[model samples]
Target chain A: MSPVPVLPAIPGPPLAVNLRSAQLVYGGLTLFDGLDLDLTGGCFTCLLGSSGIGKSSLLRLLAGLTAIGVSGDLRGDDGLPLTGRVAWMAQQDLLLPWLNVLDNVTLGSRLRGERPDRPRALNLLARVGLADAALARPDTLSGGMRQRAALARTLMEDRPVVLMDEPFSGLDALTRLRLQALAAELLIGRTVLLVTHDPLEALRLGGHILVMSGRPAIVQTLPDLPGAPPRDPGDPAVQAAYRAILRLLEVVT
Target chain B: MSAIRRGLATLAGVLLTWQMIIVIGELPPYILPNPWAVAASLGRNAGSLLSHASVTTLEILTGMVLGTMLGSGTALALGYSRRARRWLLPMLIASQAIPVFAIAPLLVLWLGYGMASKIAMTLLIIYFPVTANFYDGLRHVPPGWLDLARVMLPESRRWAVLRHIALPAALPALASGLRIAAAVAPIGAVLGEWVGSSAGLGYLMLHANSRMQVDLMFAALVTLATLAVGLYFAVDAALKRLLPWHPANPETTETG
Candidate 1:
């Protein structure tokens, strides 16, 4: 196939999320109760916590995903349900093994019984630095490349709200940094909730950093971000914020 | 050794061993004819044997096609509905309890001594494995993929989950069932022939045995084995081609 021009960048209109009085009670444990959270429209929110905390549950609650035991009044500021408007990305790429990269990226269209827009898919692949590998299978790609294809798939959805659960946590340090930068750049002007263990990643890419802590987890800090994401890690302010948040999430004795 | 050479050597050794056993035992022709006697019988009765071989081949191939279609259909039906699984599964297992060999005469009696009886036997023999394997595949689809399908796909096109995800995921398992079917399919057809038939290699073998034409009977048995082996490899090759994208890729021979 001939090279198709890249798809024009049209950012989705951002939707502000208000999850109010959220409570979750599982078997014998209460993860969180009477907690309020807000995802400011068109801003990146990074959620950092220890493993087994309610970070993922919170993200799932926002996504309206299956079997989330959380009870909350989750609504967009514009008075619309958040379910249909959300796109989800996960730690695993979740690309079907049988499909080539391009087809996987355009899967939403195929699943919806619409003819996939090939040019748009190709353009997204180009943006992800996988234009040449559009016809390549998922198993053939490296971990970073597979995740990039997934990022392209998420971008194709063009939903105003994107909920991601530790989407870059599995990558090597360098690859994770690169993907984090790439995600922040591509996800401009949308509501993005990212659950991650990396405080440095949160410092660099999060427009608003949130730290969830305690048994009945609560959002501790919605730290005031100095500027929009793709933040410079070399800055002293970022380094200082990283040190503080890193202490909260990890036990680095 | 390479695959072809290895296969050839195995064939030669088997024939050599058979000749050795006969020579050592000095058995009568009626007990076990020498390989040369069988070869001579094959050549002399080539035309009649060819007709009978062709009939048996037809029965095997026709049975395979119908069996595969019906087997896969049953598998789909079982996978498609919980109610079908609840009812059909036990009935299928109970059917297996009735030894197929014991029922061969009744099957011939009911369907008559024709191709219909033979085909039904083949279909019955293959149905369970196909349904069980394919249903297992469908049931064991990764929960993550279905979750994605639920989110990405619209609610109205729910069947698309089975089509795009579950069906493709289940193919390798289905292929396995088909392989077993192909290997065992000849037994059903031949069994039907042995019970009661006017044609096919089984009938010819029974006739030759009754007439004390031991060499002709041996020749017909050899022809049946060759047919079965050929059918197996053909199905194996086709199935391998059919599942290029499968996780195992079905091409592990070159690793050595």
Candidate 2:
């Protein structure tokens, strides 16, 4: 079968991310040390690792959301600061309970005391299939719907880079697949680094898959597959990649 | 609706019991007035009671406003600066250690016998709970929400995070503190009036008791109780309207 034209090529020159000699220590236990990673920009990279292997911590380091005393040499390809140019989505939807769907989507702008672009926010809500729920409070939505609204908020930032921590982990299989497709389609041109424990999810959504394992975790890239994401789940090539990832994850665990 | 009905029923039962005790014990009006006599007293002294009640109500309201401002302002200051928290937290906790009633005479002495002393008394009683509860709420903003704030907000605009995120997030807690403050506000005002005052239900009750006007004292006591209950409900209703997003039955965890 021909490759589906759902995902457009990432726009502009992708920002490459380089982290060297990164070290994080929590009391007597070392979570990461001498860690090095080179990430291609405008590409979706999925990070797979065992629980407590510091995958989320690595993402935090990249997002500069890590606590103080964390030492690292982190730089973007463009040499510009990565601070305001990146958008992050967490496992929980993290929608402010007080704000309605539309208001949440425009929260960033409102936080900056700028007038929110209501039309753009409404358009994004419509795209997320939540146009009718725009005025509804976030607590009123289901888990999947809340995540979709969160995705709309992430996209509304319109940043060049997006960092997500298990953004679809809480959803059911069907909702997860639908959202993965939507995320791939919507986040096509941005540099995205997603952390997940699901090998199949990583294979389906990521352009590049990296595994972090062992004490003071280190990253290793998996081989690139044939098709672009969202990949055909039934294809043997996808299955082959899936098995390889499963075996690697097994070895790590 | 059912809760209101239950409350009314309970009130009727209490009134019936009070009347029964008075009649069965054959207590004189000075020692224990019957419900009818108290009701008559309330009606007969309505004008005097209303004026005095108004004074106490003003003191409570004024003190509540001032105390809430002082408490929330202090909480915000402490929440934003670690240095402030380290320096002021112990002092705040120590302030609560001294009984507010113990300070009533001192407040009256300092602020004099007018509304200022009564307002100061209520403010003293109210300041601690509002500060403690609101500070807890501000500090306990879900780490996930703060993480989102850090990623989304620039360093220079950090105050925006406090204003938009932390402040609103803490409102439900502040509402609880305000409710508690409203319930106890009258105690301070009445205590100050009892210590030394020209007007208010507290002064009237004291004067009537001294003059053997037992019915008038009962009327003043009833007026004070009504003011306390009314103010509490008013503040509670306002908080519910202001913080509509706060779960009505928050004690139960959501299964979903």
Candidate with the greatest DockQ versus the true structure? 2
Q: Lowest summed-lDDT stretch of 10 residues in model 2 chain A?
A: A1-10
How far in Å is the alpha carbon of B138 misplaced in model 1? 0.6
**What would the DockQ be for model 1?**
0.58
**Residue lDDT tens for model 1, A60-122:** 778776555778889999987786678889889999888999999998888888899888888
Q: Superposing all C-alpha atoms, what RMSD in Å does each candidate have to the true structure?
A: 2.7, 3.6
Error of 2 at B35 (Å): 1.0
- Name the 10 consecutive residues with the lowest summed lDDT in model 2 chain B: B247-256
**Model 1 per-residue lDDT tens digits across residues B1-256:** 7888888999899889999988899988899998899999999989999999888888877877887787787778888878988988888787778878988899999999988888888777877777678878888888777867766753646588888888988888998888888898889889989999999999999999999999999999988999889988899889888777774644775533
**Candidate 2 clashing pairs?**
none
Cα lDDT tens digits for candidate 2, A182-205: 999888768899999988889899
